[model samples]
Target: MSSEEQDPDYRFTLANERTFLAWIRTALALIAGGIAVVQFVPEFGIPGTRHGLSIVLTAGGGVLAALAVRRWQRVQAAMRRNEELPATRVPMLLGGGIFVVTLIVLVILVIWPPVGQ
Candidate 1:
């Protein structure tokens, strides 16, 4: 086996790939959530607010997917050079932000719904 292949650092690269996949899955879930909000909310004659919220969620998901790909590349490069892994708290922060926003939207949609069909 090649020296690099046998190197312990190569294991980090595998970990990076797994992390990338996890992010992609998260992005997909965000996208699905957005779609669900758009699809189901309107059935109850929800107001424009739901449409706006769905748009935001969809945009956030797309941005997250793009960022995940970029992060994966950076992690791969860092691994190849045996550098310290890049910090990853940003994704977690973004995820939490998304969750909070989604929850708020859901609560608003449920409690003080728009009047008239």
Candidate 2:
């Protein structure tokens, strides 16, 4: 309707919104994981490691939640403006963050093993 920007197709807009919601869900899961770890996971042999990991997970979730909104807005704007979609580092960020967390968890498990094992 605006001279500068036309509305994008409704389907595309809905798809973008769905993606945003998925990201939000993932973010919530991460934050819950952090809480679950602190509440249920056994303490790491290295002092403070469990707490540190929880903090990292919760913080990453918070950051991703913020970035999801930003990415959604940028994509919506680009679609309306008929501009090339913006490049996003979200995938790499999520992958690398998970990779690092997994590596840390692996190391902890190797060094300390599980309590029952």
Give the number of the best model, judged by TM-score. 2
lDDT of 1 by residue, 72-109 (tens): 98777666666676887666779688788968867876
Model 2: per-residue lDDT, tens digit, 1-49? 5798999999999999999999999999999999998999888777688
Please report, as a residue range, the 10-residue window in candidate 2 with the lowest summed lDDT.
Answer: 108-117
Q: How close is candidate 1 to the true structure, as a TM-score?
A: 0.75
Worst 10 residues of 1 by lDDT: 1-10
Q: How does each model score on TM-score? A: 0.75, 0.93
Q: Which residues of candidate 2, in runs, are more than 4 Å off?
A: 114-117
Whole-model Cα lDDT of every candidate shown, in order: 0.76, 0.91
